[model samples]
Target: MSWDLSFMFDDLLPALLVGLQYTVLSTVLGYLIALLLGLLIAVVRRVRVVGPVAHGIMEFIRTTPLLIQLVFVFTLVPPTVTPLTVGVVVLGVHYAAYTAEVYRSGIEGVAKGQWEAARALSLPLRRTWGAIVLPQAIRKVIPALGNYLIAMFKDTPLLFAIGVTEMLMMAQRVGQPAGRVMEAYTLVGIMFLLVSIPSAILIRRLERRYAAV
Candidate 1:
């Protein structure tokens, strides 16, 4: 039997589009959270007073499986009357933990003289970070951060397990009854590549631009 692309375009497209919207939203929001939280965590790690706390937090997050954390947030926590807002928050928090280490490495890679110069000026803590350290650290790490963003985007599909219907879930819905699993799955993969590949290229260009500066 022949597979009909027309049927997919006519019927399944709407569901896929909706799912794609959610996927995009989740990734964007999650990345925003990751960026701010990760930087804060990195800064904390750098400060000797908070170093132990930062180390413990990082170790816990890195050692745990994300899937298990997802289940706990979605399933078990709801019994205490917490909303699914908590679940999505957990998802963002968990990923932010991973991203934090990425940021820490970036910050630590900066020259010690930079921090010393900022201190020598007697600049306020926030101003020092805002003016000097962060600019250099973040610029140097843009490529690595971009890679994390891509991974986070792909991981959005796992939200389906918690009843958040995303791209992969849409593919399953489209393919299950029609028995066009290959076609539906293939289409989803193509769409992901279409979105991710260009972003990755742009990130590489950014890396080069920042590196040149």
Candidate 2:
């Protein structure tokens, strides 16, 4: 049978938009959690006492599949917690391991002179990182972080595995009753392309901008 382009746009789009809302919400909130947690992991790993343990944990997280982590969290967490919340936390913590590596590279990329200069001034450790190291490191890593956000956006469909009713899940629900799976899934692919392509272009621009620094 021929594709129903009209139904794809008129009926399917709206429903998918609702799902997109959840997708966007999860990505944004989850990315924030990842950014912060990754920074924390990177910073903590610099410490003399707990560094090895933190390194081991980060390695473990990075080595595992995010799908496994998501399923594990969904099964292990109390039902009182919403599936969305579980999805967000799992996505965040999983990506945080990678982001931690991003952060570690960024932090390490800072010139040794900067750290020595901080010491030369007798600057407090907090001030050294807060004022000097992090600013430079974060600026350098913006492109990488944006790329991860885009990756997370595409990965939102995995939320379906946990019954989160995200975009792909919404598409399936809308299509199943009407037996319009082609229209539904086609639109979903279009939607993803629409968002991801522009985002990828923006990230490239960011990479150029940051690389110039």
Instruction: Compare the candidates by TM-score and give the number of the best one.
Output: 2
Q: Give per-model CA RMSD.
A: 2.3, 1.0
Global lDDT of each model?
0.79, 0.93
TM-score for each candidate, following the candidate numbering: 0.89, 0.97
Q: Once superposed on the true structure, which residue ranges of model 2 sit more than 4 Å away at CA?
A: none
Q: Give lDDT tens digits, candidate 2, residues 52-95.
A: 99899889988888888889889998989899999999999988
Model 2 clash number:
0
TM-score of model 2 (CA atoms)? 0.97
